[model samples]
Target: MEKNKKVVILNILLVGTIILNLFIFTSRMRFFPWFIEDAWGYLGVFLTAPILIGIYFMLRHFHKQQLVTSTNKVIPLFVAATSLIIVFMPTTDFLNIVAIVINAASVFLAANFLFNQNGGKNNYGFSRLKNQS
Candidate 1:
């Protein structure tokens, strides 16, 4: 599959995991407003996180099509970010951290693909001199 398509699939799975975890965790929580109070707010916020994240990534993905690109540096950056996310996941009740890690991986792969295809684009922005003689 194409790198970008794979990245989108990863993102969908990641977000699905997050939303699923939120629902599951909240269902098990005995002290945090079962039917009313903050439960609704919490649910909204939880759902919002992945939705918003998805929107951002989707925007970035499409934007990349419009004179957008990537680099090898982005791969390392994603690796570092994913590592941090893994390190922090064990401490949290929600699995959003896992989502972040997956997102990082997708981005890294996309970046790697981008860099491999365009060494010059990696070193600098897209050429504005295509108009030059």
Candidate 2:
């Protein structure tokens, strides 16, 4: 797939994973007892492992294409680490807030990456300038 397409897919998957995590968190807290069960919350948490792996491969593909910078590469790792913390750590108010902040940061980073893909160039108007003789 094309680079932009791949990035778009990555964003979608990231959002989906975040939503899944939210569902799991809320369900465990009995926020949506009718919609989601505690058992399903466990299942959702387990499902995130593979989704995180997929995100890593997608980022690796971008790295191979030179579309992603070395510094930007660390975002996904941070995201995965935070995600693991969410899974393994006891669910507390502080941890929930932290997870929300991290997820928001990741979304922002993805947006920044998409916009700066062309190095912030605004290519407009005529392509060539005429020289004065």
Of the candidates shown, which would achieve the greatest TM-score relative to the real structure? 2
What are the clashing pairs of model 1? none
- Flag regions of model 1 displaced more than 4 Å: 29-133
The local distance difference test score of model 1 is 0.45
Would you list the C-alpha lDDT of every candidate in the order shown? 0.45, 0.64
Q: How far off is residue 70 in model 1, in Å?
A: 13
TM-scores of the models, in the order given? 0.27, 0.66
Residue 40 lDDT in candidate 1: 38
Q: Candidate 2 lDDT, tens digit per residue, 1-133?
A: 7777777667666656756665555564555564554335545666775676678777777878887666455666666677676768766767766776776767677667755655544465322444435
lDDT of 2 at 21: 61
| C-alpha RMSD for every candidate | 11.4, 5.0
Query: Model 1 Cα displacement at 51 (Å)?
Result: 19
